[model samples]
Target chain A: MRTYLDCYPCFLNQALRAARIATDDEAKIKRVLDEVGMMLKEIPLDSTPPESGRLIYRKISEITENIDPYRKIKKESTEKALSLYPYLKSRVVASNDRLLMAIRIAIAGNVIDFGANWGFDWDTEVADTLEKEFALFDYDKFREKLDTAQKIVYLGDNAGECVFDKILIEEMKKPVVYVVRGAPIINDATRADAVQAGIDKVATIVSSGTDAPGTILDTCSTEFKALFHNSDFIISKGQGNYEALSHTSASRLIFFLLKVKCRVLARNIGVEEGGIVIQAGRDR
Target chain B: MRTYLDCYPCFLNQALRAARIATDDEAKIKRVLDEVGMMLKEIPLDSTPPESGRLIYRKISEITENIDPYRKIKKESTEKALSLYPYLKSRVVASNDRLLMAIRIAIAGNVIDFGANWGFDWDTEVADTLEKEFALFDYDKFREKLDTAQKIVYLGDNAGECVFDKILIEEMKKPVVYVVRGAPIINDATRADAVQAGIDKVATIVSSGTDAPGTILDTCSTEFKALFHNSDFIISKGQGNYEALSHTSASRLIFFLLKVKCRVLARNIGVEEGGIVIQAGRDR
Candidate 1:
């Protein structure tokens, strides 16, 4: 992804602010400013935007000086998701068919995400539509299916979404493993963050092995492969996971995410912008 | 400065490597590995030592990520001086002294920073010594025989070493107007560093309205001030300029820069380390 010229000033502003905090001397400040000015003059700004929504999303994350604003928004989004817990719970209880029950469990698992407006939301909306599309879904069957699952892997997204994932895990009434993206990028949930959020108590949190949203089979470790092979269902969150794994032959991998506008995705899914998209492996 | 444990993995290695062009996949590799296992948990058996010395310095300047590293270093250091070309040249040559003829005019305007090291080769041994014992000097000869007829305003240091004022600017051989601390907290340059640097070009670069390095004398414009005032010489740089006149000074101000060990400055200086200084000024 290329950074545009418009963002160059922001970088300068951040750098200057950092310099100010570092020193309070007139000579030091002047020197630093001069160097910065020269740097600005030298580096050519990239005008091109990224090809993938994931790249754009990551760039936005990198460009922000303080993570507080994003954290606050993520918290709000989590609260919204938590508030919908009753609806999610009721939907699970009302589902009758085993497939519908599995889908609901996958959807609930999908709550873990980086938490932003993008194509993943569209996937959730699709999950929501599935309840209306099928008549066999009932709450008891969903509960029964969740209870019997051998293992469940919940992929986490952004910071606040981890909070929501925690809530969802508690409501699952089944043994589940929470998966974090590991070190793919800055500010993503780590084992430390998961522990800080008290997620360690409810589910075993593991690394997905790649920063991209999709499951790149080759990148997976022996432990991850074992877990994937043994799990009854895989719930992947966000566009990154989808991009990496959507074309794979993995049968149980279910992607839930909102759609950000991207030409490739729009063409593939026959949708102009990202929204809820849920594809059972056979559909692809 | 002591780096934190958390900073070691990213800052010492990955981030540092990314600053050089040798490995484009540094961040990507870290990200991929991080996804599979916690970054901290997957410590490498053989970690490579950072490339040090002048070559590392030169290469770092060419890469973008090195900017942050330089900023970090700047934050850790004390005092910085920026010396860009034209402004420094004009200030030195303005006196029209015969000794000024020896200076390399082509490179005369090239920036020469003191203190903080940049990713380039520059001497620091002299600057470091001056930073420590700056207060033990008496300038009775320069002070008693000073001429106010020149209307030169000598710039003073608000913080750190005032050595440059004594050594460099004093060599210009002009009767300098010295400015001292007025309401400020500590010692500021009163023609000290200029004397030390053997500068004879300064008529005066000092405080009239305020002890602040770049304080603007707002009471009179060019018309009223020029009648009473002689040809004004403004030679000031560093933090004082940033604080007092970066925004509002009316006089033609010369600014010198040096990359310092400060995050804020490193970011502003737009370099990975220190040494490089810039000089710029407003044309009156």
Candidate 2:
């Protein structure tokens, strides 16, 4: 989706958050804000928010001289989510509809995101996601695609969310290629984060070759692009990837599984903020 | 009173809000954000937020070419508050501690502020403020100072809030020099707004000379500075005045009557966010 006017303030807020995580020195933090503020002047409104997010994170890293600012947070999130893995798996196993339960569990994990600026109440979020009705539940299409698909491409979002994604990937019962960012950006999963979440055990983890929090096809590695294009069944995860791929009209059926986080994204997707969506295919 | 790191993002948010109020053009709104972002680079940490707030609003005016963006909202707020005046006055009159009730009403009015970024629920806020316990209630000190004080300098806050202040001024039964902004800034009360709220009938309305949201002393008119300095009793209303004057080492007994609005101000005053404070004098 194209960047909205509301995204401008959010961009600065996210920048400030990353800066604080990267450094304790107030001077350095101020410098990061100043640089990022100036950077906003050049950002185009037509580009997806994640495209600009890439630059903001890069600037933060440069100013604070602390690469991978969310590294500690990512590790903590992974460990915490790993502890809940068994419980999550049990819910999926005990459910009448295992696939739907796993999908809910994955969307519930989307709350762990740091970039969304929403508070996380892990227990409540899990319960609520399991009980709450989806804004768009394209379950029949999802089941049909999964039934016929041989190779599934699963797009990974954040670190902790990878464990949740693992549950869904297992439920898919097919050969899956899990995609992660090439490098660190916010708490977005890299190869290491996915490995920590045991995603590597369930599926092959591939880098999208862009350190961006989302999958911008133009910036993706040739191999990952090939895999994305070749697969007829794709499960796009979280706001970032959804933003980058939401409007793409590639010859594939993509299912977006996420908890709507912001007003702009919610408006674009025709969902209420904090609502879940199991959407099928590209939206014009 | 110094600008907190947290205030930087808030500054941009406020600028965007003011910009949206000023114009419907998306490009103009973007320009406002871009300009405000660039302006943050020069804002010093030691300066009061209102000092930078002055610049942000000025930039909005320059870019949008709408000097008084909140004029219509200010008028609407005045009309809304005026309608509540009779009921509010009746509550004060029925209370045994009329002054204290009046003070609560004034603080309740503080919630009408547009700059705080908090949602408004007029009926609920009035009822809650009347019923809630004050975080810092210096009632005895407030009464003691007001008892012997000859002249009072009451720093006016937002436009609609002036009507609430009028009730308190009536209870004061002393000559009140109601201070207002020299020019339009945010929803801050100016001479015209105060008059619209019938403040002219109750108190002597005067301009502070500074168009900043708060009473920034250095930028005030010589007349206002004299009035502020000479008065032994001063009633400073809302977060803006508290932020600007919280640390001022003036030779006067100032009572800060405000509903705690933001985290930074809440920390500075040792009050929790969303709580009421009737604090007397400055803190080191």
Candidate 3:
């Protein structure tokens, strides 16, 4: 979707979050925020919010001189998720409707985002997302699409969340290509991160070859775009992917599995913030 | 308190609130936000958040060409409070401790602010705030200060909250000067709003001779500043007044009767947002 006015402040908030993670220096944080301010002032109203997001994170990396500031945090986050994986897998395994349980776990993992600038306790949020009723559940549609699909592409979001995605990929009976970021950007899973999270064991892993913190089609490599075009079904994860791909006119069957983290995105989708959504992508 | 990193988003949030009030035009709204972005970039790190606030509202007025975007809302808010006045007065009269009830009532009225960008069911918020125990109640000090004071200057915040201030003024035995803004700025009370709220009937009413949406002493008239200086005690109402006057090192004893609104301000005061406070002002 085109950038709404609400996205403007969120851009700054995201910048602040990255700057904070990048350094503890007050002057540096202020300097980065000031730079964010100037960029926000000139951003075109029609551009996608993540397009500007790409700029803000680039600036944060430049000013802090730590291209992958979240590297340590991402490792810690992955370790934390791995520690909980056994219990999570047991819950999914125990459920009579295992496919449905896997979907819920995958969507719950979407909450691992740092780029969204939300602080959440993982266990509570996961339990809440799993137990709470969906605000937009396209379960029957998802099942139907999964039944007929020849090839599937799964988009990955955050570092820790990539591990969680493995459980859902294990449930899928199709050949799955799990797409990760080309490079590090605000805790989004890169090739190194996805491998560390062990996503390589569950699905065919490939890089999107862009560091926009989301799947911006124009920036993706030819190989990734060709895979996207050839895939019969796509599973886009988290709000970043949602923001980037929601406006695409591509007729490929798609499902957006995410927890609504931002108010603007939630409002755009006509749901309250913090609601779980299993939404079918645009068909046109 | 100095502007926090968090205030960057809030600045855009506040700008949105003002632009929405000013007009329905999307282009106009975007223009003001873009302007707020530029202003946020240059705002001093050492200054209070409200210092930049003054610039934002000014830009809103200049771009929208509506001097008082909150004019109709302020009138409606005043009417809403006036409708509840008799019942609220009865509550105060029947209470065992009249001053405490009145103080609660006044702080509750602060929820009526348009500058804070929160939509409220004022009746419910006022009722809730009145019934709820204060997070920071300095009752003994407040009572003792009131008992000892002779000349009193009461600084007002929002237009709707002015009526609630009258209730508190009625409880006080000391002569009071209810100081309002000299002109319109957001939903802040001016002489006209004070008169509309029947504040003139309860106490001496005067303007601060400036519309900064808070008490900026240097920007006020010579007469208001002298009254402010000479007064034995001061009762400052709402977050704007708290923000503008909190840093003052004046010798006059001051009581900040406000609902802590912004996270930045709440952090500065070491309180949670939405808590009612009867804070003692700075002496250093």
lDDT against the true structure, per candidate, is 0.40, 0.90, 0.85
DockQ measured for candidate 3 = 0.66
* Model 3, span A1-284: residue lDDT tens: 67888888778878888899899998889889888888886788787777788889999999988899999999999999999899889989899999999999998888898876578888888888889899998999999989998878999999999888999998987888999999888899998888888988878899999889889988899999998987778999988888888878762457999998988888878899988999998855
The list of candidate 3 runs beyond 4 A from truth reads A251-253, A270-272, B121-124, B131-138
Estimate candidate 1's alpha-carbon lDDT, on a 0 to 1 scale: 0.40
Off-target runs (Cα >4 Å) in candidate 1 are: A1-149, A163-173, A184-188, A192-201, A230-232, A251-263, A271-274, A282-284, B1-284
Ranking by TM-score: 2, 3, 1
Give the CA lDDT, 0 to 100, for residue B284 in model 3: 52
Model 3 lDDT per residue over B1-284, tens place: 56788888788888988898899898999899888888877888777666677788999999998988988988998998899899889999999999899898988889997776487777778878988867777779888888988867899889888888889998997788999988888888988899999988888898899768778776799998888888878998887777777877862368888888878788888888888888777585
> Per-residue lDDT tens digits of candidate 1, residues B177-216?
5444332211233333333333334443333434222333
Error of 3 at B229 (Å): 1.8
Q: Compute DockQ for each candidate against the true complex.
A: 0.01, 0.80, 0.66
Instruction: Report the C-alpha displacement of residue A190, candidate 2, in angstroms.
Output: 1.1
**Best of the candidates, TM-score:** 2
Q: lDDT tens string, model 1, A183-224?
A: 534234556556656678889889866543345556566787
Ranking by DockQ: 2, 3, 1
Per-prediction CA RMSD (Å): 19.1, 1.4, 2.2
Can you tell me which runs of candidate 2 are displaced by over 4 Å? Answer: none
iRMSD per prediction, in order: 14.4, 0.6, 1.0
